[model samples]
Target: MTPFERSRGSWTFPFPGLSLARSPPDDRPTFWTRALGETPEVYGERLREQDDATWRAIDPTRSKLGAALCKGLRELPVPPRGRVLYLGGATGTTASHVADLVGRRGGVYVVEKSPRPFQRLLDVARRWPNLFPILGDAREPRTYLSWVPPVDALYLDISQPEQAEIATDHARLFLRSGGGLVLALKVPSLRKGGGRGPLSPAEEASRSLSRSFDLGPSVSLEPFHRGHFVITGHYRGTGREA
Candidate 1:
């Protein structure tokens, strides 16, 4: 299942955060949130809408990005034809949908440290040409820099205690001017070690990101994932402070 169709004409921000989508006529209204097409699809169930078109249901429970969209996230920082650097690619679940969202013009460079996950990501990439899977660590952005172009956005879902630092490092290396960044802060990662410095995990990440990007509102993936926060922003580059 792949690209084609957004929520509506001219309203492309993040694609399909429609007021109508929140409450549809069906009992399972939230099941199918489409950018185009009418037939409702199941979560994780991939289906072909046409000979040349395919759509995969983005399960809110399975993906934080999906949860954010369902939770009234007004803007999608990643634009059409925009390149994205997906940290912690994680078997290509969310990465596949993102690849679909970007279409053929744009590409997503996914970095996964583990071999098991990278192998699965490779399988997903075969179906979609826009997805490029890299067997590398997210902490070392430079290791995979040569494989990626100047990306339009950087999305991090790594569980490292220093995940924010890891994401920021990549942004500084690869993100272009005005690029979007979405960092999923896993609170438990920091909580286990009693944390360091004075600031809380979320505040520290926000402060660090603020240095290079003009951040937007953040949302908690409550009920879906406990103590998970998704933060989005636009990179202004390192030389020119935001």
Candidate 2:
């Protein structure tokens, strides 16, 4: 089976954080990421050690990105040693996993506006060499643009009315022409009455993003997250490669 597929309730690891083993015969597949460093439990996730490496179980219920992967997201832009700029990285739960995926060579620059969670994110970043925390609003990307370098992937999970617009602005600024874009579209944040006619909020966001991105596999985070869609694609803005 491909990395994204679930065969008989068992999953194959997709990218950098590969699985150590298949799930038990009676249980469903569990996703695991190799711990980045000598880490303590973050968010109380289960941990195990094998082959001289620590692995942490990623709970889909608490993570939109994990939910998308659990629901069989066909494509993920994050590659090993790939730099990522993560917006709305609340308390570093999901950002920690992203750091594990990228390993020591690559880094994840996380931006969070709220001071409360940003404090916790700072603590998390202390333990993770590859994780960087920035206290700034994702909507105003320029506020933290100086801190973030050009990245291979840009991920947005902000709860804002202009999520797509924010992503577009950041993509043009930080993402390389062929870099990846992963966004968690929150429907409730869209304009009341669903914004555009007939089309759902996810569709509307996808349509707007299509102008600059070559949209790829879009997954619904159902059962784990309601009214959430994880959109994946590559940036095709000006000067894109042929």
Candidate 3:
């Protein structure tokens, strides 16, 4: 039988670490991830109990990765039981879901620069032993080199002008060759008030990423997040630094 059964609103496993179901009264599609352990309601997401599994809905408006999935960007590199290094994991909203997706066997090394959000992230980490929180700067990826291993995928969502540069830098050091990459590129950061040039922000970011990665589709997070695009790629490990 297929994962999604329309006759009964049962949870369907689509991507690694994710579940899908139709919401009641409307039949609208909903995204969910299985909770690894006893985790409190970190975010205000609804939880459902069915088939002896607890699932939490991923809020697209709050999570860029969730918005990318809801928007139908399919090249997710994060595999089941694979390691991931998540940059800019603010308060662990998306990171929590990722941890659930990776399950107990995999690990998620989350790096958050700020202290306030990092504190909240610490609280979330306690619930999932596999989640390791690092309070450090993403711009300086080497600082946390000891904390992370050669990951199967790298997820970047920092709000910096050098978004593409940062992703490539970290990928070079941590991600294995041909590993998957997901970047949440904020358009305004790249433009910096500059008028539209021959290349759009997404195009410019793509150009920069093409140096170190075999680029894939770039999905736009529209109403949920204006001026944000999620770019997926595979690290080639052959291109020179941009």
Candidate 4:
């Protein structure tokens, strides 16, 4: 879908620390530059020179969400200004971009299990007022379920072998009816055996997700990154049971 056709919901809250304004309508080149994994130096220079608020430096090696956002922006549902729950918000790289997409009016509750990543995520959250970083495991939804209300979307990028199951569990609790979900499945994490196999690892991962949700169209990022797939699904009109 074209950017103009994309849906824009009401703004909930505009955080003070997030000073970066959206890029100008004519700045297609700038959008591509930020979409691709521009070097930190380049990203910083560009941000400073252009005074652009929408652009941020993302570590491609660490974040499949970043890669997916770059390519799958069009597919992501426009979230309501209510709330968003992001699982596996490692270091807040992709979470920050999501915060931008959700805008200040919306609330983004990011959950991360690792203390190391949680620390960094906290730092990123401090800069973006709308983001609330929760240090907890995605596998255990009950731990953080009370902290977040029902949300418009659930974004999952955890690399666990049972990543699909984990995401589904959280979706059941946090996602509102007709809410959206985006999952970045790591094929190797779900693979059972080593060496070149007849059944592609990605196919297996896809099957696992298909069992729980109506797997929507997917974007294969193998050209940009190896063994990675970005899958988006919605709870609405999906007959699958929780």
Give all candidates' CA lDDT scores. 0.70, 0.81, 0.82, 0.63
Sorted on lDDT, best first, the list reads 3, 2, 1, 4
lDDT of 4 by residue, 1-242 (tens): 33322122232223222222334565321121122122223213243322242244343444565465445444565363547789888887777667766766877899999999888787777677778999998878899867887787788887777777776777678787677778887777877433256656666666656665666778766555787888887764332232
Model 1 per-residue lDDT tens digits across residues 92-176 = 8777777767767878898889998788787777766788989988867778767888888888898777776776678778887
When 2 and 4 are scored with lDDT, the better candidate is 2
Best by lDDT: 3
Candidate 1: 10-residue stretch with minimal lDDT? 16-25
* Model 3 TM-score, all chains together: 0.90
Q: TM-scores, in order shown?
A: 0.82, 0.89, 0.90, 0.72
Residue pairs in clash, model 4: 12-105, 13-104, 13-105, 20-53, 21-53
Model 2 misplaced stretches (Cα beyond 4 Å) = 1-14, 20-22, 193-196, 239-242
Per-residue lDDT, model 1, residue 148, is: 84
lDDT of 3 by residue, 29-95 (tens): 6678878759646699888775677778888999897798778776577878889989999999999
- Candidate 3 versus truth, CA RMSD in Å, comes to 4.0
Please tell me which model should have the higher lDDT, number 3 or number 4: 3
Instruction: List model 2 lDDT by residue over 117-189, tens digit each.
Output: 9999998998999999999988778888778888888999987878888888998889878898889987888
